[model samples]
Structures are given as C-alpha cells and as structure tokens.
Target: MIKFNYPDGSHCYRALHTAHAVFRNDDGKLIARAEKADRTGMYEFEITGFELLSTGIVYD
Candidate 1:
C-alpha cells in the first residue's frame, strides 16, 4: 500500500505498484503517480488537484 498525506494534513492511500504507479480517479483520469527514490523508503510523488503533502513507506 502507499501512504499519502494531503494538503490539509489528512491521510489516504492507494495500491502499491511499480515505480511508474498511477493514481487515477473513477473517470479513469490521472490524479497522481509515484517513483521510488531509493532504499531509504522515500518516494517522489506527482499529484494533481490536491497538494502532495508527504509520503513514506508502510512497513508491514
């Protein structure tokens, strides 16, 4: 899973996928995407409509 922090400090998530993961809305339009930066649990996120507040790994 992918953990997401919203602009208002709220949190949400999406299914974890490859580096080129895509976050789309119900209309099949793109919302955001992610790329793994390194092994340090950091990732680069590109989002639309809402601000990309923050991101981190979810250790199971």
Candidate 2:
C-alpha cells in the first residue's frame, strides 16, 4: 500500500501493486487516464478529481 498526502492536506492511502484509472468530467468533456508502472515496480500518479469522493486503488 502507498501512503501520501492529498493536495488538501489530508492523508491518503492506496494499493500500488495493481493497475488503476481516473476520469474527469469537466464541462461535459470526459478525460481519462491510467497509472503507469515505474522502474521501482510501483505505480504512481498525481490523482485529481477526488475532492469530494473517496477513492481506492483498483486491481485487474
């Protein structure tokens, strides 16, 4: 599991040994992306659009 701080100063935790995706609907436009694996065998990303929603890592 990965632990970090959000942009709002809140502590966040997520599972890193898996794949995940994110989506945003801004002004009726849909934007989507996925987390990429790095050399450290961990997936990393700066997740956004999670201000009011609680999110968790997804494994496939």
Candidate with best lDDT: 1
Q: Residue 53 deviation, candidate 2, in Å?
A: 23
Query: Model 2, 1-60: lDDT tens per residue?
Result: 544444455655545534354444555432323344453443444443332223574622
Error of 1 at 52 (Å): 15
The window of 10 residues in a row where model 2 has the poorest summed lDDT is: 45-54
Error of 2 at 55 (Å): 22
What C-alpha lDDT, on a 0 to 100 scale, does residue 11 get in candidate 2?
52
In candidate 1, stretches whose alpha carbon ends up further than 4 angstroms from where it belongs are: 18-60
Range of the 10 consecutive residues with the lowest summed lDDT in candidate 1: 45-54
- What is the lDDT of every predicted structure here? 0.49, 0.42
Residues 8-59, model 1: lDDT tens digits: 5565555455334447667655455554445455354434433222357334
Best by TM-score: 1
- Per-candidate TM equals 0.31, 0.28
